[model samples]
Target: MEVAEQRSKVVEAYIQAFEDRNAEAVMALYADEATVEDPYGTEPIKGRDAIYAFYQKAMDLNARLSLDGPVRVAGDIAAFPFTVRVTVDGKRQQLEVIDTFRFDRQGKIIEMRAFWGPLNSQEI
Candidate 1:
């Protein structure tokens, strides 16, 4: 299979893993040295261990993700828009987000960045 096809498939698997609320499955899609920067800027979580912890918390939030649009693949990166339904502080909130995943040669995600902020969120 073409590398681009493999990369695109990885993106689909990522969405499925999150929908399953299976952190381990999600981690499988990442490289050991992966880094994640949720919401573009803050502090990036570096390495697999840290990345795992970050995702675990997100999983614990009982977050449900729905694709808002198609996944766009360019080179080794995949970007897509999605909506997240999660409960925080006893309130249900929805976030409209776009995330980009940069994959390694083997198609494992080596970097991930999520984009969203107050303007993209709403109390549901």
Candidate 2:
């Protein structure tokens, strides 16, 4: 697979998969030993199963993801700015986030990093 050509497609799929609350579809883009570190500072969940579980929990909450800007691709990594809106206890919250996905030669995401923090989120 061509990394440059496929990276944006995979990123778009990821956004759709998450918005669809389809953890399995999200996992399908990951490598067997992929890692995910949402928000970047905490411990990264490693391996496919762990990553799936992580996404499962969030998707279960009915999180909706939408791109805020164009996806940027550089070498093996693709980055995008987005907003995740979810309702908690009948209150809607939105978080502004940026995520970087590093792809393997086969075009599967090998590592995913999300950049966000408390300041990036607020009740909506």
TM-score quality measure for candidate 1: 0.94
Candidate 2 vs. true structure, TM-score: 0.95
Instruction: Write model 1 residue lDDT over 1-124, tens digit each, in one string.
Output: 8776777788789889998988999999999988899979979889988888888899999999989888888987999999999999999999999999998877789999999998999998
Residue-wise lDDT of candidate 2 within 7-74, one digit each (tens)?
88998899888878899999999999898998799899999878888899998898899999999999
RMSD of 2: 1.3
Per lDDT, the best of the predicted structures is 2
Report lDDT per candidate.
0.90, 0.91
Stretches of model 1 off by over 4 angstroms after superposition: none
Model 2, C-alpha of 40: deviation from truth (Å): 0.4
